[model samples]
Target: MTFKSLLGGAALSFALALPVLAEENPAIEQRQGQFKLYVHNFGVMGGMAQGRMEYDADMAQTAADNLFHLTRHDQSRLWPEGTDSMSVDGTRASPAIWDDLDDFVTKFAALQDAAEGLQAVAGDGLDAMRAGFGPVGQACQACHESYRDEAS
Candidate 1:
């Protein structure tokens, strides 16, 4: 029932659902790959924040670091125009992503800020991690709400 164990179970279940091969469209494949990493790392932080897992500084730091690393990467190539769900069969990306590029960029900026804050506090202690978790989760929610379709 500990947080780490619970997250481990969830992660295993999710791993079983990951795509086995790259999509024919590189954009969909790349975005899905990015999302898989995001889901895995975010799940770790979320499990600790929700008290489903024990707070381990090392584990928290590692998870935060993974998220932080993602924010630093250039993901422009993953979201080309015409790659949305409306046009593609394998993706759930909203067309609004390209239509509202500025907002998406802003949300990503917010994610970057949150990731930096989480990275700074992740290894400090539970209180620090708790304090930093909200902004990152919120940033993710903002982007998902605007650009991602709910899973079927």
Candidate 2:
């Protein structure tokens, strides 16, 4: 091939790679926002279950069940290969999570365990539900402290 043709082909290949490179940095805002929503719902249900708020056994149980589902949802989508930090619009997720992936995975699994524990006792009564709240809350706080933004 002529030098000019080879050079043009190489340039075209590089341009084509840009989109793939961009995809490597997936947006994390949606994931973070979902987590925030989950936290809000969790608080609402937990409050009711603890009698800190008006009790509605049905609503509280539904919320607890949803929380368990959210915890079990695939979380890896939030972090892409070779990605350490993700910026979606203005929200920031620290790269420390990818750097310490094992720790991140462990915390996530712990959170799931806690959520499941809460779910298992959700139908028994408020006292039974309250028994699992502390560990679950701690799991969330631990992961947020390590991976999420401070404001989060």
The most accurate candidate by TM-score is 1
TM-scores of the candidates in the order shown: 0.82, 0.72
Q: Which 10-residue span in candidate 2 carries the lowest summed lDDT?
A: 82-91
RMSD of each: 15.1, 4.6
In candidate 1, position 72 carries an lDDT of 89
Write candidate 1's Cα lDDT for 5-55 as tens digits: 999999999975654233767877987988899889888988888899999
**Tens digit of per-residue lDDT, candidate 2, span 18-131:** 433323344455476677878787888667756789866677677778899988888767666533344322344676877788998999899999999987876667777677
- Once fitted onto the true fold, the runs of candidate 1 whose alpha carbons sit more than 4 angstroms away are 1-22
Segments in model 2 whose C-alpha atoms lie over 4 Å from true places? 1-26, 49-52, 81-89
Whole-model lDDT values for every prediction: 0.87, 0.73
> Judged by lDDT, which candidate is best?
1
Could you tell me how far off, in angstroms, the CA of residue 104 lies in candidate 2 after the best superposition?
0.2
